[model samples]
Target chain A: MEKEISDPTLTVSGQRGPASHERRIQIIKSAHEHFLQYGYKKTSVADLAKAIGVSSAYIYRFFESKQAIGEAICSVVLGKFVVALHELASSDMSASNRLRKLYITLLDMSLEMFFNERKLHDITIAAVEERWCTTTQYHQTKYEVITKIIQDGRASGEFERKTPLDEVVMAIVETLYPFSHPILLQHPILLEQSEPEVLHQRAIAVSNLVLRSLAP
Target chain B: MEKEISDPTLTVSGQRGPASHERRIQIIKSAHEHFLQYGYKKTSVADLAKAIGVSSAYIYRFFESKQAIGEAICSVVLGKFVVALHELASSDMSASNRLRKLYITLLDMSLEMFFNERKLHDITIAAVEERWCTTTQYHQTKYEVITKIIQDGRASGEFERKTPLDEVVMAIVETLYPFSHPILLQHPILLEQSEPEVLHQRAIAVSNLVLRSLAP
Candidate 1:
């Protein structure tokens, strides 16, 4: 949380001209597709360039490295989830209900990636493993949203005001780690038997504990 | 929790004769040493055989595969922590205090493996990724211990009895995932900044939230 995490999507680096911007977006789109088709590790810069009718060097003109492209892709993919969290936090509902929905939504998104978007999940695993800035940014953004909800809950007299804000936030984040962390979610034990309904139930149960802790 | 998990350490085949038992123990000891020194994946069965002055087939006589050897080692390694958890749960301390110490102890043990036993940490990653029976048994045992403490807390008028026992246990288990799951502990973000004191504080903060939820 001490380090500043810049958004990779905003730093795509091909803003020379409108055409150059278009080319970069085109390259990123093709790269995303290639990553999905052949997986992040299997799809190389050469493959991406060839698929886009460009050279590998041209691909580098946009992305500094394969991992950079991966970072860009992850930013876009994880950005949606962050936006969802923001919307959920800002929703017109009780802070407690919003908190419950937030975790359940987080679980649903993660399960989606694990079940339907396997290749994207692979990229996410790599991103998390490699400690991509995007992943750090995502977590920081999540922390901020959770902090906002806790503040709102306190303001609305729905949650306890005695516990330190940082402590409560850290505790809630740690509680959600298994659902939010890709590696833990993909662990054989969870992945093997994670029927969506069962995971939802677990998420609700965990959220209830968080709510109970926050009760005034 | 449905599958019955047999103890790998208790099933260390070759209980034929006293010398045979001695030889089996020697093989496991050498393998554990080699794995610690060279790494689990890098130390092959043949390498272990050469290190122990025995044939690979001889090693296989007592173990089915290299993974099986890893499982046995993991069982022995994880078993110690399981014993500590049982002891903590059975202690005369208040159930709430015992629960707090349990997670702190869990965090300490994981940190010890991550910081001091890097090779052993690698073996654990493999065990978790491969879904070894030892890992499953370790989790189940941990779950049962947590359940026991929660039961005691409720009986002693320390914790609420309204929530379903399974729900509370699952919530507590999920809450402790970051501290207990080896892969999450090894994540770059955590490993990079996890000074023991900082981690212990986080553990205490999290345990406090858990106890709040359980309060009568």
Candidate 2:
């Protein structure tokens, strides 16, 4: 791995903040709920500060704006995904099974977060669509995980990839797009069928497809 | 094998239009350009009518709303894809080669439409996000094409799909998604890399992944 990515839940530097990192985490936790309920645009900094029992000035010391707070919340969510993915990567399973589990878990997590706190999903969509650094960093993390798995799969002789490693990773990521993207989860209207179970089934099938394509 | 989808470009009943079907097609052709120029929301009936040298009421006689006009444009664009796909499918190529060509052409068409007429891509995204019947019907057409190709592949002993044919088809579409979807095209910012050539390369890589997965 080029750059080791460890869990940074406690270490992610606040974009700009009051001295206490814990205080920033507290603010994010409070703001996440309000943002989800009211959406990114409707949620106000003054209101979030009030809910967090901090003055609006204090909130500003932690976040530049409502959108910034939403972005921080996004980083926290992505951080959690990374942490979970780490555990999945270390699990004692075949490379293909591990990859399959990673996608299933990733999609399920997105769907859960989307339905449970859609505001986060909405904010995440904006973060992604705007190519916000938070989303980009998360995707970078995902890319590394995929490359590592593909490398291990090749080393174990579990798969033979005809393309360059980066290209193969791109192929797998694009292949799993519909099954894993948060955008797809939020926009069931975009799919031919919106049933949750059906999407899950498709996710599994796609994993198998990728794994089959890689058989050595 | 089921649900015959053929050239209905000349036959779709206008939402509320003048008696002449040809006139409806003419109105759609005109509105398509305006929709591409000014976006779905900005372009108005009056502007479209003026551009076509007709009264706003006449425009309404051929289409119910600016959105309806947008939907018709989507239908027309989708109709063209189906026609082109038929030609490709009927060509004497291996099933994998034919499937590859279908996605390559579909994505290139989206890119061309996006760059040439961004407003149309914008409107098509709305129609898709809003689940307009035009977009859904196009998907249905795509589904049929996929089934036909897969069936041909199986009969020729090119594939041994372990899953149900629908599941296999879902895998293929999901795999081709980032390459073929209009929403993905318009939101280049959402992707990790937005360089057109890189996206095209990824599209080819994903097609090979699908074809390899299906090999008997």
Candidate 3:
């Protein structure tokens, strides 16, 4: 087994200067593009380094290996997903309305990622299957965040208390996970329909079903 | 692409007698074992032939290639699933009772397939991703069988009329698909716990939720 290490250059501390931050973002964006086009199995460190105009040794300074970089990309995407849900949690809307908005936002984000950021989805799936510990912890954190929001809704008398918060959160995540991952939608059977309008309607329908189930 | 030809040997026509039927079933069983051990990508025609105590040329006499054998295995499994649902549809139980039984049956069948017939699950996942036109048609046929059961319930006043049959079908299939497929369960994250009992209970809970929503 290879030792995996996290990227040190891309700090979340918000202490990096603008130039450093911009450079880091540039490398990440380049890597993301390469991974999406070629997939994790085919993408090489040298390829990514060449694309980013850096030596392979210098690329290693930021990430330990291709797998580490892929994990970082997944972390970035999942972090963004958590932030979006948090934003929804902070809103002053009814529980059902917040959930409705959350679903729509998630579906749109997924479509954008599917069309433009497919590599991230592949990395995430690999992380889930291969890097189970990290992926499970990440899911636990996200589940906690969503569970807290549901609990808050119950406290505010905006949602029912009948359903278990954990179950509801898991169900919601399970229902939306397919739409969030491009590999799933990439199925030819699912892609048979060309109308974006119809696909959007299907997402809305699924969202509505979840909301109705959670309704007080 | 190689010329696509349907397996005349697998057809239910009178051309294949009892002995041929028995041989086809034996081939599927042997191929299933090979798939479980090596996955769809790694499993070869020669491997299956060796496992079945036959020459590679003899294997090809019945099926075109390794992929065609996989298709045959999937068809056998799916055919059994269709038969189970058809029997459930004709039962005279109340809607809620029938739904409960259906959920339990699916969970049990999925577990059985996941543990005992892992190769079939592996091939099915490959079939889904490869979008072999035959696999897609097989899925559609399975969906149609389930849809007709739901439709029968609706017409017989056994189920509520307002439920979205397609969405319900998708949700049920999606939820059970991974649980049924051994490859997905082989992930360490899923293997960490006793899943069969918990999953069976969850299936019941989800079915109840759907039935409550659909009840008139």
Instruction: Estimate the TM-score of every prediction.
Output: 0.89, 0.87, 0.73
DockQ for model 1 equals: 0.62
Candidate 1 residue pairs in backbone clash: none
How big is the positional error of residue A143 in model 1, measured in Å on the Cα after superposition?
A: 1.3
Q: Every prediction's TM-score for the first chain?
A: 0.88, 0.85, 0.73
Q: Which ten-residue region of model 3 chain B has the weakest summed lDDT?
A: B1-10
- Model 2 regions lying over 4 Å from their true place: A1-14, A18-23, A43-56, A65-67, A161-163, A191-193, B1-26, B42-56, B161-163
Error of 2 at A123 (Å): 1.5
Interface root-mean-square deviation (Å) of every model? 1.8, 1.7, 3.8
TM-score of chain A of 3: 0.73
Error of 1 at B154 (Å): 1.4
Chain B TM-score, all predictions listed:
0.88, 0.84, 0.71
Ranking by DockQ: 2, 1, 3
Cα error, candidate 3, residue B213 (Å): 1.9
Candidates sorted by TM-score, best first: 1, 2, 3
| lDDT digits (tens) for residues B1-216 of candidate 2 | 232545435233337845458878888887777776677777788988999998999878777777777777776777777777667766788778889888788888777776767667677777777777776667776777788888888888888767588878888877767877776666656444567788788888888888888878
User: What tens-digit string does per-residue lDDT give for candidate 1 at A80-176?
Assistant: 7877876787788888998998888888888877776677767888877777877877888788788888888898899999999999998888888
Where model 3 places Cα greater than 4 Å from the true spot, the runs are: A1-27, A44-57, A132-159, A181-199, B1-30, B43-60, B132-194
